[model samples]
Target: MESLEHLTPTDREILNKSWAIVSKDMQQVAVNIFQMIFEQAPDAKLMFSFMMKDYNVTDQDTKTRIVT
Candidate 1:
């Protein structure tokens, strides 16, 4: 596996800056990420208890509950 140490200083800086922005709304970011994971691999939902039931639920608040 490639190591993060291979990343240039500029690359690290970009990642840090992006993380700072993303951290501001981590809940929504988490939901979006998880949704993508489930969409890409439906079987991945079985790994999380919260996701095992009714994935079609559209309530943003309920979806974000998994992250919290």
Candidate 2:
């Protein structure tokens, strides 16, 4: 995976702002994936449920402690 260290200050600022928007889109995609899994394989719903729960928890913690 690539890192953002190579980005210039302006580029990093733009990327940060863009990421705020992209994160919401990604959350929707995550929910869609979870719904698909739930409909297609009921047994796998637990995995998706746990995964999404952890993601939300971590995101909230990070937003509160670091992002702000």
- After superposing candidate 2, which stretches have Cα over 4 Å from the reference? 1-24, 48-68
Which structure among the candidates has the greatest lDDT? 1
List model 2 lDDT by residue over 1-68, tens digit each. Answer: 36777778999999889888878789787788778986797546345445454332334645632121
lDDT of each: 0.77, 0.65
RMSD of each: 10.3, 14.8
Q: Where is model 1 more than 4 Å wrong at Cα?
A: 55-68
- lDDT score for candidate 1 against the true structure: 0.77
lDDT of 1 by residue, 1-68 (tens): 38888999999999999999999999999999988997898767757777556554345855633321
lDDT of 2 at 17: 96
Ten residues in a row with the worst lDDT in model 1? 59-68
Clash pairs, model 2 backbone: none
Ten contiguous residues minimizing lDDT sum, candidate 2: 59-68
